[model samples]
Target: MADSSPSLDPVELGAYFDLIEVTSLLRHAVEQQLREAGELSYVQFQLLARLGDAPSGSHRMTDLADGVVYSRSGLTYQAGLLEKAGLVIRTPSPDDERSTTVTITEAGRERLAAVLPGHIEVVKGLLFEPLSRDDVTALAGLLAPVREHMRATPPRSAAPRRRGKVS
Candidate 1:
């Protein structure tokens, strides 16, 4: 007789798939709406939002990159585009000549304010309205461990490689 058994992977069985799907769907919906608003990419909107929350309407480029998951070069490129559009400005950092600071322009603030209502509606439609109060609480609880793990683990550094020399 042969044994029949089932295999279970708890991590896989848990929230990963649902989280990924929900995140992707929400992002897509929000991006679509923001794109239609005519001046901001979703990323640009997020950048502006971050600057709006900063103490002086500005942030160090490195800090902004970390907040938005962009690399330094990536943020530079995005900031350049935003500068050209009059939505943001890059200024020399007083504390560090090597680093630049980004500030949201008045135009950017106005643009974000204009689209925020629609964005919030889309977010509610896609992510929130469908969920009951209990579902939201359950999701928050379920995600806490994943969020904590991500925060606790430092990003991996590249390992040194052995050099090959002619014998």
Candidate 2:
């Protein structure tokens, strides 16, 4: 006996494919510009920007990780790289020895300031420049619900586990 199931419509699948392709293209464009300017990766730029925007240019590492989309271990690794580059420094939190505080160095601030204008221009060109004011407002409105839903949902655990043999 043979089994059959309905296949996904090509048109519907193409929409999802287009979405991924467009997002990848935009990321690639931005990354290329950033690389031309310097060695900063998107994640590094984001982390520095976060610290730069914080009060006193400092934040707890955990809070920084939470605000950004990186895993805790990933954040630590990146922070280590930033520290090695002398763009950031880590200090033991006065209130908690277990927690470390990260601060943007003068070098970090200068680097971010230099890169920011170009980054903004690229963002405007790739994303906002094409949109009218009303279109930008509408796009922001459309994304709000999804952002809220994501914030409301807690993240899952990242624990490692052994895989078992399947029957």
Using lDDT, give the best candidate's number.
2
Give candidate 2's root-mean-square deviation (CA, Å): 4.1
Give the per-residue lDDT digits (tens) of candidate 2, residues 1-167.
Answer: 66577666899699769767878988888887777775788888888999999878998887787778778888999999999999999999889998999999999999889888888888899889889999999988977997788977564223443479768
Clashes per candidate, residues 3 or more apart or on different chains: 0, 0
- Candidate 1: RMSD over Cα atoms? 4.8
Which parts of model 2 are misplaced by more than 4 Å? 1-18, 155-167
Number of residue pairs clashing in candidate 1, backbone atoms closer than 3 angstroms, sequence gap of 3 or more or interchain: 0
Per-residue CA lDDT of candidate 1, range 1-167, in tens? 77578654887766668778989999998888898885678888889989988879999887887778766667788889889999889989999997898999899888888889999999888887999989989878988997787757542222233478859
